[model samples]
Target chain A: MAHLGLRRFPPPLMVLLFLATAAGKEEYGGGSGGLRFRREGGTFKVLQVADMHFGDGRSTPCEDVLPAQQRGCSDLNTTAFLYRVLRAEDPDLVVFTGDNIYGADSSDAAKSMDAAIAPAIAMKLPWAAVLGNHDQEGTLSRESVMRHLVGMKNSLSGLNPEGIKIDGYGNYNLEVGGVEGTLLANKSVLNLYFLDSGDYSTVWWIPGYGWIKASQQAWFRQTSSDLQKRYTTEEPTQKEPAPGLVYFHIPVPEFGSFTASSFTGVKQEGISSPSINSGFFTTMLESGDVKAAFIGHDHINDFCGKLSGIQLCYDGGFGYHAYGKAGWSWRARVVSVQLEKAESGEWRGVKSIKTWKRLDDQHLTTIDSEVLWNRGSNEPQPI
Target chain B: MAHLGLRRFPPPLMVLLFLATAAGKEEYGGGSGGLRFRREGGTFKVLQVADMHFGDGRSTPCEDVLPAQQRGCSDLNTTAFLYRVLRAEDPDLVVFTGDNIYGADSSDAAKSMDAAIAPAIAMKLPWAAVLGNHDQEGTLSRESVMRHLVGMKNSLSGLNPEGIKIDGYGNYNLEVGGVEGTLLANKSVLNLYFLDSGDYSTVWWIPGYGWIKASQQAWFRQTSSDLQKRYTTEEPTQKEPAPGLVYFHIPVPEFGSFTASSFTGVKQEGISSPSINSGFFTTMLESGDVKAAFIGHDHINDFCGKLSGIQLCYDGGFGYHAYGKAGWSWRARVVSVQLEKAESGEWRGVKSIKTWKRLDDQHLTTIDSEVLWNRGSNEPQPI
Candidate 1:
């Protein structure tokens, strides 16, 4: 009791001291800055980034390889730009939606490419990632590009030690700062069903010993029923009561305009494979309680029409490339939703909303809110 | 132009045949009987089998997850027993050998859990196979497995249409035949090399990429170099005079042991991780008109001692358990080598091995000398 006041330290000084101590440990090195928001009185801000296709080596021109018009940024340059944006915004938490890297031909190149972007990875903020179609290629035959990305050597050596990386192909649930969230969560939230959707083209290529196969759809249906019980109760156990955000790569619910612009004309130039259908998305949307769906793909900044009271939001591509001809440029932004807490400390409903400014403009234009949400209510909303 | 012996055909009979053919056109069905071998003639027979795991799955047992030992034969059973006796008899061309699937964690139950029998794979004449190490766990990552097997799928698939069936892991290759005599005559003799060693234990755990982690030691150093100068002579106009035979699972100089063995003692446990030095085998063995090297993993019946001046006969495992307490058990045999010219005038090598004998007291005594070739020369022979 002699000097309780003497030992007390200021918040900024305490943070600096904690960081200094963490830096001494080899594991904590490099992870210096991250997204952080402090409100004057209890208000906090969070930023969400999805589908940053960094280090995807489709830069060179090849007739049989990438589409001619689509080739622009090399994987290194794109990844470097992504880190630049992360350093600029310095948000509280960055929620990476999916498709972190385009895994296609050369996995080693992709990995070394990832290592070169180590500075961006070291940005210490807590970030969560989910897998996309590009990440699941390993399941088809073993020789898939996804295998290279998820392999132990590549993942460990290529990734920054501090980044909270998650397998895009697996189901995971995480909670940060009392705001519980699930990425590719099991098949249900309030009786609504969800799934990895796999590669929309081939239903047979399930990953991980086929542990997560199409036959598991039955389990998903059952789980969805179980989740509904939690929401039906007057006082839910969790803080967030709003359904849940379903994260995936492709967009759902056919938007004629986007489809026509993105894929329709490509076939005329000799490309025959049709763009995948949104049948899986429609099925998930039919399930109630799936308030929003978040997806990336269809790099153009656009959104689908609201379907069945569900909002679809398409997180724009993280790589630098302008969509259409709007020198407007590419930008990374995060969406934060405030939920109202009930008397019992459980989330009862939506509270307020906040949208962070573009992390940096590398040619990315509009953010597709509908694609990210999957389904939106008829009611009006604000930024 | 030399002469024509013309015979008049009956119009009614010919008309009947045409009508019958037209009627049966819609009734034609597609599918081959899974177990049927058509015969082709040539001197000196050789057998070819790919992806044989000797000590794999069934050798090592895991608690709760696998069945008890002794109740089943591991995938290595048929291949092991057949090779033991096959190697003793010096067959002209024992073409295929590989994948003695033995792993510390592999259990017999895992091998037999599926209806596929290791014996069925070992059925036959003198043969060789490229090694695969599914039996060894942790030694190969899922990514590496896929990369090595699936990466070459397109190239391998283009070789043969009937060979495109996917297994539990979706791995496959090819088997072609030719005559040793014709191989010598055309100066473009049948040259076959068994490639694909499971996962190189040293670099198996790398995180980002698997197969490309480094150039696969087995493929680059061992198998490829095994017949270097013999096929590629110094003179630009003068091509190498002969084709040779090469066989192995994990190529050579890769991860598995090739030079040493634990005949007896407490050190037997350490013998499991054999030093796989493929240099000598690749350099001296199978050069200058050699036919083939029938090989299997060390866990099975591997007769590594060289033969003739060029060919090194390796008849290791034929699918049953490698070596048993009462000597190698299970029965399989390889036919002598046969050579023939293909439509392209290139000599083709073929072996007609079959597995149907029982593991009786008489069969387990000594290895057949007719199929196994003992080394006779000190000079290195380049095939």
Candidate 2:
């Protein structure tokens, strides 16, 4: 029963069970003020949540239903919880993993826009979103919903906005809080590779025209080499880029087909399926100083595993009833990372990582203070 | 029951049932080897099919049993039947909608590859494929598989052996039998825009990366105008670009999500969720002269419908069973198009199309050769 011969328990059933359990939990207790950050010495505390399928709450009993409803409800609650958490922690910055929307076409996709911009607009907290699958759907039309989410719109003359650059179809890079990250690029303080995967409309059976396309892969290789050159100096160079973080909506090495065998009656469901660009992810992890990979899609409780010396963390969905009832309800996790100072004063590596799960409660308690924290001798102390 | 809202049957079930019933029972015969040529003819036929989960005979089911099994079997048999049909029709060209392989990461993926490619190679025909959901499941490199199947590679070195001209990022254009098409170009004789839909690992819910970013969209618009100017002639011209055709894997005017809905104490399955770029297909359809679109995803049987004045056809699976037990088999289809001529011998429009289904003698036969020939007055007559 343990292995079940590659046919993991049907995904729909798992989703249902997760939902039933999640229903028993209370709504997020943290109010809009929860996501605030306080200066902790020389470093800042931040939260990272990806693939929140906002506006996906519909009681539909279809194969892909849980993700839909979960996305919608989660987005609203997540926003509310994020506000509360921000107020409580007052982190300096918030880093969103990806999958800001369930999809561009979701009836509730407008909610995603609200989720992404509302917090930053309301509290003036700096937040950045890496483009995910849901964010990339739809034509790049002025009237399309995705266009609005990414702030991509035509000017009065029907020309692209000045600051906006369409980097190779969907790849992009930007800086937040003086720290830079590039999706599919290596050279940055934090190299966040936001990959496209591929379109669902294309042939799923074939291996082209999707995420990790050749062009993107080539760009990634070049960027990695460039980062190595900049960051390998004995002295802390001003031009040197920082470590890297890869973010996407789907998990690499896909868990398995949710409905391949049960619904279709085909025998080779999980056994024959492919894994998401494992080689690419591995290469990046090995080649560059990739601190971590934040991802979503497998909406179970957090599972942190390593591949090729690279740490892979499945940051559970920010959407509906992801893990279980008692899990992080309407809440996302904030990770405060500080650089360690070696005896020589050069940035050695990650000095400390403190994670907080912001939950809703009438009064804040120490239990809700911090869920996970790791600090080294060279790490900065809390204020 | 007739007006059953989405609650009654989820999108997946609706699509599955539609495919099951729509897998027509007509038996297709072989092609008539008569060559017909018209210099000024501007008509050509194209076939579209999607989600051919080939090599599912030995597939292991995912958590969901019925749908997976059914989809697997249907996909495999349907693909086989499609091959037979394509060989019989011997059309001018063939277009693989998408999802040619069941799971690119599966152990049986190699077998699936063999099954899916056998017919295409045997026929010595030219075809193009887009990415699909099931295809993005595993570790099978998309670029490698695409290069093998399409006889083209994404070249970073800027030298293309397939004779296609590639951009710096491996994006390129190809001329299939004299008709120029770009893999991801703004313009071509027929602008074949191959989009990169996100992978299962990074937001499976969304369908595809919307249109080329804003900058690309501008280029697309300008390219459309330029192509029109370069190809269209107010007066009779000796030379002009061929009429346009758009190809990809997913369908447009997005369908509903692939989830489960509560139905009589049992949850019903839905179809795959729509992408944010659902509007892009509509926009492309609205582009004048974009006569038809070929896609593959719903792998039941061949059906053509019109949206926004554009004809859309799903070519059914190349390896799975179709619908009816009587019609169940694996196969592909070929489309032959003949451009209509004006009174002055100038190109006017597409004239006619004929579809052939592949079936064994054990199945029932219903296709009438004479009826097919009669449908198009411009049908090529044997010498």
Candidate 3:
């Protein structure tokens, strides 16, 4: 559980090499809007807050806290940690990779869920989420949890994908459009997919934790295909599917394939993956557009590893209310997708996808920074 | 590891209904002629011999044998076991799924490999093979082992897929042709795939047993696609891609997703999968052609479970030199693909795929008989 994931190790030096200046964000004018970057200097940043495990509106006691930090420690500490990261990062989008609340600790799941989502709403930032295995244990059903999130302010997550029958709620995709007024503005420069990995086993045969099922996979793949076709139709010059990212709770069993030494960051415990693999990793891999996937559920383990062509990453345990080792700091992951500029200096598509983690420690130190996928990385293409 | 695969559990009852009085395999006069079944009563039977772990000739001491059985046991016992199964099953095809020779135990890997294939050679059956993790631990480079296998009599194993570069050797496919003189004679009614699931980790980033690589997966998908197109072209009225079966040495890590109670077979050991999942299961699922994948690496774990649409199964250990519990008899698996006759009583295509295992005890106990897939099973189609 404590072993870090793959590929983040290569970045400390690379990020230092590219201390590129940044411009403010741009307003992309398209239905696939809500995210954009300037041709000259801007980049789209996404902050992944994993396993917040918020309960009871900042009053619940945090687990795995140091004695000295426990004077007034509670869910407030988790809130404070998130505020610090959000203030420091000012990300274009926030992604909560599940366990938004510790349902068992809360008196009312819906009320506790509001507390969990309050920061993103208060910040007026567009955010999206998928539920963890524990999100349904209290007052509300899993479907209710997702519906509530979708109805929240500035929320981009869908209750489910449109026009398709699939497993689980909150199975949807959001398109991050390119620069405004450009021919590519209609194109989804970056695509993000969110899927609920379910709360528990539904059948006696494939028992253990819930996993992404086949119907959900079929939906994801169809959505991916449609997105790719749309991107190509919008910009015929584009060479591949728009760079995509996936978010889900509960790592697929494939995450356990790596040894402690194989990944970056730290793995403190075994990967608490579902008993059945469900093949989503393969599904995403085949999709070809997905460059990286962010997951939560193994609270103490935060690492990134490149498997096949895609990077399997953990956002690290980002909540004090979640169980983590006392010595490990609660942390959130960040990705900055830099857009490429054309010869005439107009914004093109994604130049690179870079990632790093910021710990909740006093300095708010950025650790495990690395380039996840670059245009020139020669990532595998679909047949 | 003891649990049997998915779909197989329901087969015992269904297979009883079909009782499928199998006809002797037919001689389809086409390039894909090695395997066939007549419209009247034919069925294609394939015997899976896993982890033979043969050493020099017939004089090696077998491990995990009952004391009385050990007194006169040697490699001969394993040879005898194969002969017994072959005689009883009279399979049209014999598939040796890796670990064909115990390189560490053998004085010469090449000579020991000869002994391993002698049964099939003497029996003069059409055979194919893919190597296991232990096959290259001796003198021969993996490439050389496959080269030798390909040059043998009645061998269908390839040095590698022609015209495409990929990871590992012996990646190839064999097509079972339709019955004699039918319009579908050239059509590959039953496609069989064989891939060498490498001997060990070749890269520092992925450690443990060698898993399928991205390049290999790419090749497999391409091959699967090509095969599907050919089948459709050959039989214009066919609704789905032809049924396919893949054979390899090591089980993909997804195999561990099942609980002991979930599968029908006896779980005697843990699934020894590679450190990384190379996306082949998803690839096959996407292909919409593959029905079941047969693998061998974990010597004692014999089970089959369907994931998504394809069934992942292990051929129980068929060699005595391989380690096993004393009472658990070494066994071989059999697949009988029955073909359907047309309304005019001519061969149509594969009607159903059924499987079972035969333990190497007196009476050669037949057990775990089940139908893996049928045209009416409504296995998931490609997205």
Candidate 4:
């Protein structure tokens, strides 16, 4: 059997093996570290496929396929969508925001999951995922799914053996290293927090949604504060803490907090309902580390609005098995952040970040292009 | 034509008329003021009939009536339910937490509203209300509904000429004074904030739920702070700021911010979906005045739990026309706050608060009785 976890191979050997094999992959930012960004100043592109909801080849019908198609089942549709997006955007990293596989029978889940992620695996592209509410609804538990995902080649999922041991799974952070002259030894230029928002409620008698528990909140606060303290030191390039983005399956309650007038894109469906107010959003807002949050449960709703200062956005539907209106077109959100040099001859952090959606039909047309965050040219230097 | 408002009547004359005609009524706390409380230390009972959904007598059918009944419609059922509760509980105050009148037709909404409130009016009982999401679904807007409610015989609704004008309606506060011995003028022993969680979204497309706007949140914070400052003055009986309870139709986003294990009641269905986090709950937590909040929108799902420190509760279902399970026994929540003499021989603020639900089956039985808040004997006096 293939290795089920990163621990099977030692860290140094794994790093050496990854670097040796990653030479031909254009998507891989070839470096000594596990996951690295551009050493020279350039833009880091990320394509997010949210709410894939893929199923076994026979069980789930492909909702987005043409009438004449025969093998338009969930697995086929997911593969085609991923292949299309990969060929079109060629992102440095691909992030799957939960619901990647429709939980069918446990026996077929491994093959189904493999087929769902086959495009990325075949392309030798780096990818990561957080389990969604529906990912564990079938036979396989979330831990089992994590094992499968972590075992895949070029998978960047940091599912620690002893993560949040409560009800959820895969509560880990991934870091992208700064340039060589970025001044900080132990600091990263950007951080990505992936949280498991958990499935249905187990404590309450009535089966409904659950919130991020107190333990997770505590973990988040400690980790976030640690990151902020580590990066906010008086280093020349690090005047402020590095900006981060949070991704999870179910959108936080604050996702519903903004006005529609403030939104820049189409508000198709209203926000999908959330069961409770997990203080995760409040924690991020107070920590000031998270500049934006991207969520995927509400497939039809794709609008980004600023709530209190952080941007809350929805990645438009990317799955064919999920429910959505016809002709609405399945799309994926592409986010790119660029690095620049400051006037003081120091490498500054991400200069600007922009986001847009690419149509997944015959024509790969980009729509709703908007600048989510910009480190202005006239921004003052640290005193 | 009948009077649409009380502005036509002189204030002093109306007061005199109310005082003259308000005799022999058990519900009227007959003192010099408009609505008075018990003089000696005792419990003040409040029966909340939430989500009445009273229609214009014909358009909406009463869903809970017996099969043999002929007048099985919304208006009749609402009136009967109110009359039954009033005759059974004889509560000190009847608080209708929105959705009182289902606006079937704009022209007949006035009569429908009048019929809905006739039971309390005939009993000369003091009452108040907040608008719900469905209250103004027809031609009559929330402003018109508030106007009609304010003009009623014994109404205590504080809807002003110019309220929260941006999105919602009737952002006002009601006061429950302490025993006559408590010191301070223009001060209250307990405050009840009634907010209009507005109807549908005029901003977002697809016609889903809307959130409490920023302006309303600001209003709540300012009003709560002012009340806290006013009540925290150096009075012999008032050692601490007075306690408060907030009532609205749609719950704040923090209502979803709790775990099921943290909940204490029967988790029939999880908390009804809240669209957005308006930061109202955070404001209440920070201001340290609001002890609990009661809401009534999802008719069948009624559960109460502590999010942070504040208690978030539901009033259960009281309307027969609304959608709920068959023969599930519609109910209303009764909240009572008790005042007790402190060591200083002065009447202290609310000593203990209890809640119970009354079922509307063949017999009236109170169930799920729990003490939500209490000033324990060993508790230190507020200095």
Q: Relative to the true structure, how large is the alpha-carbon lDDT of every model?
A: 0.34, 0.40, 0.76, 0.67
Which one is best on TM-score? 3
For model 4, residues A1-383, the per-residue Cα lDDT tens digits are 11122123454654554454444323323221244456555567788888788877556776745565536455566578789889988887788888888785324677767877888889988888888877876667789987778778788775642532333677667666555434322245677777787776553322356555534554555566666665664233366667777887787777776676888777777665445454566556645667778888888888887765577889977888877666777889988877666686565577777899888778878888888776643121110
Proportion of the native interface contacts kept in model 4? 0.02
Candidate 2 segments exceeding 4 Å error? A1-383, B1-43, B56-83, B103-115, B131-140, B152-229, B233-243, B256-270, B274-279, B282-289, B301-303, B321-336, B346-383
For each candidate, give the interface RMSD after superposing the true interface residues on Cα: 23.9, 18.5, 10.6, 15.4
Position A68, candidate 2: lDDT: 38
Query: Candidate 1 - CAPRI tier?
Result: incorrect
Off by over 4 Å in 1: A1-52, A56-76, A87-98, A105-113, A116-120, A135-168, A173-195, A200-224, A234-241, A253-279, A321-328, A341-349, A352-359, A362-383, B1-383
How many Å off is the CA of B62 in candidate 1? Answer: 66
**Candidate 4 lDDT for residue A257:** 69
DockQ of 1: 0.01
lDDT of 2 by residue, B1-383 (tens): 00111012454753454344336521211111111223434534444445555545444322212453454443434445556566555544455545666674355555565566556556765445555556544546655544444443211111122232221111222222211111111112233334333233222222243222222222233334444563454222224343445555555433231122311011122223233232344234223445455555544434454443344544544544222222333334444555445576554433444444443334523221111222233121210
Regions of model 3 farther than 4 Å from truth: A1-383, B1-33, B38-40, B381-383
Model 1 TM-score relative to the real fold = 0.33
Tens-digit lDDT track of model 1 for A260-377: 3442111111111123221333223323445555555555443333444445555545554222222333445555545445475543233443343353354333233212231233
Better candidate number, 1 or 4, judged by TM-score: 4
Q: For candidate 1, give the lDDT of residue A354.
A: 36
TM-score-superior candidate, 1 or 3: 3
RMSD of each: 23.9, 20.2, 13.7, 20.5
Shift of residue B316 alpha carbon in model 3, Å = 1.1
